[model samples]
Target: MPLPGQQSPLMIHWEASPEKQMDCQQKGKNNKTECFNHVRFLQRLNSTHLYACGTYAFHPLCAAIDANRFMLPSHFEEGKEKCPYDPARGYTGLIVDGGLYTATRYEFRSLPDIRRNLHQRPLKTEESPLHWLNDAEFVASVLVRESRDSPVGDDDKIYYFFTERAGEETTSFFDKSHVARVARVARVCKSDVGGKKILQRKWTSFMKARLVCYIPYYEVLRSVCSLDGGGWASTVFYAAFTLSAQWRTMEASAVCRYSISAVQRAFEGPYMEYQDSTRKWARYDGAVPEPRPGSCITDHSRRKGYNSSQDLPNSVLDFVKLHPLMFEEVKPAGGEPLLVKKSVAYSRLAVDRVQALDGRSYDVLFMGTGDGWLHKAVVVGSGIHIVEEVQVFRDLQPVESLVISHAQRSLYVGAASGIVQVPLATCARYTSCYDCILARDPYCAWDGRACRATATMDSTGLVQDIQSGNKGCRSISGRGSLPWKNRTVLQGDDVLLPCDQRSNLARAVWLLNGSEVLGMGQDRLRVGVDGLLVTDTLPQHSGEYRCYGEERGLQTLLAAYSLTVLPEIPRSPTAATPPHAASQAANDMKVAYISAIVTLVVLCAVLSTILLYMSCLEKRKGKYVLGEPRPSSVELQTVSANCLRKGHREEEEEEEELTYPDGCLRIIPGEAPTAATSPIKELPVAVPPLPPPLPAELTNGMGALPNVLRKMNGNSYMLLQQQEEPLVSPLYSASFTEELSKILEKRKHTQLVEKLDESSV
Candidate 1:
């Protein structure tokens, strides 16, 4: 066949020798010649197969042979030809410049076929799919970069660094506009296929200026790197890079200067270094001269070439090795780029770095592996030096997640089987106390000693004892043991002191007044099954108490209690006396005094009145004279003659007549009437004693008695007569009869009788 632009005619022929003769001899039978011939034919084909890029060969060997082979155009079409080995399987390769290339065993497909099969139409209300990346197998990493032109705007771009089994691929597109400053970037899984997922992006705002420059780098083996920076004067810069392989690697660095805006367009001059000998900033013009063939660098400096420590000069090598480019510079006006923060590595296979949200850098790197093991390392200059590794679980189970609360200094590890946690400080030294051993703790266990939880000592008994100043003590004793002892007792009531004991048949003795009270034969005291039973509690019983029991041949005081039995109040004497009895006695004495005074007054008045009346009567009695003479003149002459005869007849009877001046009747006496014979001759009637003077009738009879009788003695003389009655006094009379009545009346009328006797005297 003639070539498109060639001129030589080519002729080919096959020469058969021993191998050809054996190949023909084995046409119908199997032999050593046939086998040798077949083996030679296969070898020839294998050599030709090894030359083609489609051959299954080692990477280094295949790469050397077809290093400059242009990609095939048919690999980009959506048909069986796109995937020559497996027509049914979807293509996964790279489409670059106008052709498709396979770097591994994967096939290839055009961008159009992927769009139709994987990409869905955008909702009417949603924004358009400005950036999209399908084919999960080809996507090894994704990163987002903020534009510096709109520092405060939400314009952010996404760069997808992918690698197929066959070749490396890259695609960049706008993700969202108006992204916030200091935004937090993360990847979330898409919710469609079980294993097929995509990245979901979100951000937070914390800074005044937006991120201006962001870039990502990766290798064909799926290693990833990133850098980002933004600021007013482009003075501050931060960068992060990572390489993911069998053993992962990470590098993070930062740099700052007074001003990055003063640099020129082409050369900002080589970065300076503080040489120890000179003690000054020395210009190092050959630091990172250029990125290598398979590498790229983006920054304010225009040196775009492969980067390697060997290729860089000493001055430039030290600058790049010590203070690498932290962030790429974005030239808005082609002047100095603005300042931003460090870029973060984004990879599907790389583990996310744990950082303190408080902006404090980590002194140690703590990584939780898919297998239930915790790897700890310290941060060195540019690498992590692993110090310890602990198998957190017996089985090699994957760890689901991890949570660290810095305030509590707690670390929680969530695993596929269960959850475990421990204090980070304690666990840092890998000591026995790192884990909790108490059986009751749900979230912790005892590695060997002490009580520990996720971040605290959840043992209630221990915590309570510690807080009460009995840190190492087992039980809370002292006042807390008997909660009811510090109590009050009411007067005249009994109180029980609880003495709880666990042992049966334990002899407990209570002491009072330095003597044992239990079994003392005292009726007031008793020993019950629990404690001492006090019958009557008195004020004297209130004192120190001790309960002792014999344990292991020694007297043990189990508890002590103070009992205060209050005193009973006394009753008032006055209130106890009966009111009615006292009042009656007082009334009786008053009546006696009143009666005596009235009686005495009446007696004195009666005596005085009686004495005056007696005096008057005596005087009137003297004035009255006996007038016998008038009758005598006429009787004397007749008496003389009778007297002579009376003497002779002395012994004979004699008659005599007596006459008063006021009376006409007369009695003649014979002689002197002989004492024996005159019988009779009423001796001149010794004139009957003149009648006692009659009392005058009371004129004012209001309080005096009425007159009893009236009599006329002579012509004009009037006398009020006193009626002589029974010998008994009328005042004492009950109709003036009965001796018993007289005595009773005398007692009843004693006052009146006494008055009358005084008047008579």
Candidate 2:
């Protein structure tokens, strides 16, 4: 694709073979998109030629392009080892010294493989044992050129950075033992060839070590950028790492720097070996062979009669073959991440060394986010300050690649859609010195007049601060506060006071009447991303509002507003209704209200009256209603009333008269009934002997007899002689009563004789 203001984009028609395209379409379920040629890598092989590879449908293809003409050669080479067969799989390749070094999946299975092509004898990693790589995702590759003049002789190295699943050799927690995402840095000596006898066509100087970022677990490599710092001692690798998606709930990213010396030390450490008995990984305690296994063919090796890999002893090669993993990990330069950002997934990174107007150099990092934003940050001392954020793509898409062009002074961002060329220095965007200084951009400075790019102007009289911007640019601190705009808003209406911040590092704070507004969860007031919102404005809301941006303990007023909340206007009576009409309406309302109240009261009274009537009827029924078998109305003249005998009492010589009133037998307040005055005497029925003993049910039935019998014998009186044969009728017939009275009289006569005898005794 063409850059901005460049020539029209030159197109090259590259397609897969007919057979390959047909197979891919069939295998991918007729997905024509996947059948097209997808470019995987493009590396400058030389000044005149470029090496490019692609996933041509199901087949991989490679070709050399003319750099000047931007044309591909007619003939193509097999890209089996140089490119990935699966376009979605991660792979990295680099052309160093006319040799292509690649870490990729060579076949359809997506097995991890690292190889060096374009050599007399093409070489690759071990295919068996599978300990070198496990589901590896290649991120980047670089060639670190060694200093030929060093006293401790060292050979050039090709380092490959990738993330892979942890193997059984990892000593992490049980849950992470097999599936932990481990960031790894593997290096091979440039002069290394295959072993002589033990291993052939495999790297003899291959050694891999873990890359520890901030956390000790879940380190996944996202992107890597290599910076050449004059010598091997100064060279460093900046890597972006993120937690595995399966291990984190929120997205996070960190930038960690690895120095070359630290990596070398890790490689020189003891090897990690798996113990079958313990089923754990531990440092190897066995003695290492001389000339040190996995060491480059340096001057020391040359002096040990091992100048080349072919001359090394089989013992050394065998040891190197078994122990390729180092015990120590290559931690970050500062033993921690340079910067960690939450809710952001960094996809690509490009670092540029910027010479600022302050006569110092700073490393500016261009980090691409998954949300299609480019974050520019400067490394100052022990911290990183985010200078600005630029929207690279309108749609939210992960940035696939980032390229920095020092000559064009631009950053090229590549996504799934297209590439965007962003200028490295966006100085004119800063309108004032305060903004420019607050940005802390190493590429931009205030040239005593306007904010300008340091690369495009002279540094004399220019102000720039790569460190804390407030400390270096103290003269520009006393800038005038923003003019407060008067805002007149009616009560109950909402008011919005806007404030825009250019730097993401600055925290936006809203202050009302010289007090900080902490209305995070309040309903009446709120703090939005870009402004302060006063909802349902009242008299208390009338105050001076100011938005200040604070960064590194320095505060700058960005926006201000003088808010005046006026009372809500009341509707006029004339506008609402005429006075006479209003009076009539009020009278009607009052009458309607009184009518409703009277109706409610009347309804309640009626309901209460009905309830009272029902209660009275229920009481009358309970008082007068009889259960079953209605009683017979027998005259009292037929029944004889008598008192029950008291064994302890002396015999009564005289009995009181019993009176029958209203067909009910009544006795004097203290009177006993005698058989001679009984009504049974008047009845013509003959007397009978006493009957058998009555059942309990018969005794219970006799309780419903007339009150005359009940009043005799003390309310439930009974004749003692006939007590054993009590009456059994709910109401007695005249004949039955006569019979009962006759039996009772006979028993009474016998009882009287017994009583007389007892008295005489």
Give candidate 1 regions above 4 Å deviation: 1-154, 157-163, 166-360, 368-371, 397-761
Global Cα lDDT for candidate 2? 0.73
Off by over 4 Å in 2: 1-9, 28-30, 168-178, 472-484, 490-494, 508-529, 533-545, 553-555, 567-761
Which residue pairs in candidate 2 have backbone atoms (N, alpha carbon, C) closer than 3 angstroms, thus clashing?
713-717
Residues 665-691 of candidate 1 have per-residue lDDT tens digits of 223334442323322222232222222
Q: What is the TM-score of each candidate against the true structure?
A: 0.20, 0.71
lDDT of 2 by residue, 1-761 (tens): 77899999677888877888888877862455677789998889899988899999868899999988899898999988788878888888888788888998878875688898898656778756536787788999888888456677888889999987764354435365335778899998887778777668888888898898976556579999978756666788899988776665778899988889899899988898867798656789899998889888878888878878889998888888778888998998778888998888899999988777767778889999999999999888766888888888999999999999888988889999999899988899888767888888888888766899887767788887667686544553333567779999999999888888756667777777887565687668788778888888999889888787777666677888899999998879867787789876765433333333333343344345544644564575443222233234321122322322221122243332222211122221213244333332122222222223222222212211111221122223222222324543323345446543543443333322212222221
lDDT of 1 at 725: 42
**TM-score of structure candidate 2:** 0.71
Cα shift from native, residue 731, model 2 (Å): 58
